[model samples]
Target: MKSSLRLLSALGLSLCITTLSAKELTVYTYSSFTSSWGPGPQLKTLFEAQCDCTLNYVSSDDGVSLLNRLRLEGASTRADVVLGLDDALMEQTRALGLVQPHQLELSNWPLNPDLAWTDTDFIPFDYGYFAFIYDAHKIETPVDSLEALLNSDASIIYQDPRTSTPGQGLMLWMQKVYGDDVQQAWQRLARNTVTVTKGWSEAYGMFLQGEADYVLSYTTSPAYHVVAEESDQYQAALFTEGHVAQIELAAVTAPSQNVELAQAFLSFLLSEDAQTVIPTTNWMLPVRTDIELPEVFLQTQPQRIGFSPEETEAGRETWLRTWRNAVSR
Candidate 1:
């Protein structure tokens, strides 16, 4: 039965691959996900092998721009699918009615509070807790918590909340940890911020270039150094206040000519074959529990403080204003 469906899916899954090719599916995505080094390249190869379709990716600067690009294009977009939008922006994406609803099946999903994402329009593929990463060789004393980050004098690089998801996660983390004093907290953090870039790729690159002592990144970051580069000199600081959880997702655009095929692709994203590549390629946790991770990831993944749709919608303006006012000075 499985082999037969696999064969049929390839024949039927072709949406919009290229010019004059009807069996193609165009996906709008963030650069990192589609970069030759990122999951996008492997994803296209693997999915196409099964779907008999050409998978083309039109990448934006980052996830925020990924959505903004869609909003800017409105209904005329040729993209049948979107990958790399996060739980943070789902409220805006859903409110804008930018995507059609989907009910994709899952494997290794659970009934846990942390895994509960109720939106039918967007499907969660993977999740990770946001953290500040540092070079063990550079900083003898790594700051752990939100308060620790602000109070310490160590130089850091982070993304702009208006442009990057991890930067926005840090903003929300500060708000969640320091509710009424969010403004005061950002004021203090701004003192330590050496530079703020427009996207994750830039910020992480700056850190790699030794622009700062640390950079805002995922807990799974060190796993790359440990597993890929055969180095153990990097680490994610253990925080007193748990880190903010970011669930990365994919969705079918409302204007798509093919619904079931798009939905099938979303399902393919969560399957073991795809999830297996996500941890190393995308540098985040796989949504499936049974998938084994590099022991480094298991050793370093932080505790999560999850958010709801309501909380995300209610907090965007206040968080952005607080971050902007503190740093603009």
Candidate 2:
């Protein structure tokens, strides 16, 4: 009886250890990333198969909201990894000191040369250029340039600069195009502006419902329509003023207990298997160049023009103020 009791206790302790070792890695990201249609489901399965851990995603409204959520939760956040922050948010997120280095040697990965990635803390997974998407059937003569769009009375919808990356991209684009006259440009664009949404999904959905002639979104937005719906009605209006790029990044949270697992997920993100899932599901260009893309993905490359990550951080507050004051009018 004594021997049997001791053996049972040993088995119970072993079971506890096994349960503890089978960990769960929680990643904080945007809602779209974890949606059924997004890469989250497939990525969760892929990562779990190798790591022997459950991959969990906690989502906010959008990228900017991801930063806001971190600020609210700070060190108390349960996130082992934070993903979906764009390059523009890098400086702000880093200043919080809530994220640790990924510690992976990316020299072997086939990162895009155009990215010129040198940051050690944040890892870029995907990128896209901001553009105004319009239905080709409705708008036969779409505005050819930002100046033309602003100069015309064509109704438009865009995301809020404070809450959405694409809206921030448009803010940077306006500043790049109009220079010191950006205030007047915003005031001008406000004339025909249908509404400013808190997130990209709302604005894009409104556009799809024919609420506006054009909607501010990624250049790759139409790729989803072409590939999934077998329709090419949606199109990005290329601007002669050039477009700003949003590079989505992921990093290991400093407060996480699962540092090894977080880093593993980040490493897996750059792998061919993961990169293959990003383009169609996320509707963005993969960081790796080796992935073969659909014809629509190949066609949307526009002239890239925007502030560097440092420049964006420096002027962000001032630009936000300018946008708020102008749009209020």
Candidate 3:
């Protein structure tokens, strides 16, 4: 009878282990996950607790690189979900159809109607406006407009548009403001251009180190500088031409076996708890209308440049061609 009881106990333990293992969900995202600035850990902890699932994160350096990896993996990829693709790459990802539409019960959550894209192919997590982050001490009189930057003596560092989201955003912002005369605008900017880094951090680092007078970054960049780093050297300039607002999105992979869990994770991202953490950590504006702005953000409300996703898609190729021509000249 004792021998029989031992066998039953071993079986029960094995079943419990199997049940726990089945609840784990794996997520793939950008390398930003490793930073305390990112939402990865918080997301993992919250989701695991709510859904009784273990959260696994796989990270890559950039969104485009992650998308490319997803393509290479086809339907067999281990990633159940992907986060960090922005408006710039949304069309490309949508065209690839690598992600399935997320049908979550988000009726209780108040999402910005304007931020939604195509029946929830992707959900906007956080957003921010793009601007020039410059050293207040280095620049005697900071350039207040795109034209000023074009004509000023201050060295400017920006990421390359083809590779960086902020670079693409600035490119689109220029096109929106300059219209048909955008080629000329690029010509004007090229004259004062110092260098183009591969990503935002590198460009911002150069600005902080005083290598350049300005770096292309978000309007909330000053918030990070003040609250996180406790340095006032960096401040985002208010430009007359308006700032480019970029929204980062999250989506469920088409082949993900854990669709319900992925959808739950998406809903949790927009929760008040998650939204509250974003301003402090990622330097982004919360999509939820109810969340209060942090003190640093209260000083600088990001200016909205008038450019729709449709306009962005229509002009992107032409703008790139013109940008290349202008750079070469």
| lDDT by residue for model 1 (15-41), tens | 332222347888899989888888988
**How well does candidate 2 score on lDDT at residue 68?**
91
For residue 90, give model 3's deviation from the true position in Å: 2.2
Off by over 4 Å in 2: 1-22
Best-fitting candidate, scored by TM-score: 2
Worst-scoring 10-residue span by lDDT in model 2: 10-19
Q: What TM-score does model 3 achieve against the real structure?
A: 0.86
Model 1 bad stretches (over 4 Å): 1-22, 107-113
Alpha-carbon lDDT, every model: 0.80, 0.86, 0.75
In candidate 3, what residue range of length 10 has the lowest lDDT sum? 12-21
* lDDT at residue 142 of model 1 (Cα atoms): 88
Model 1's alpha-carbon lDDT is 0.80
lDDT for model 3, on a 0 to 1 scale? 0.75
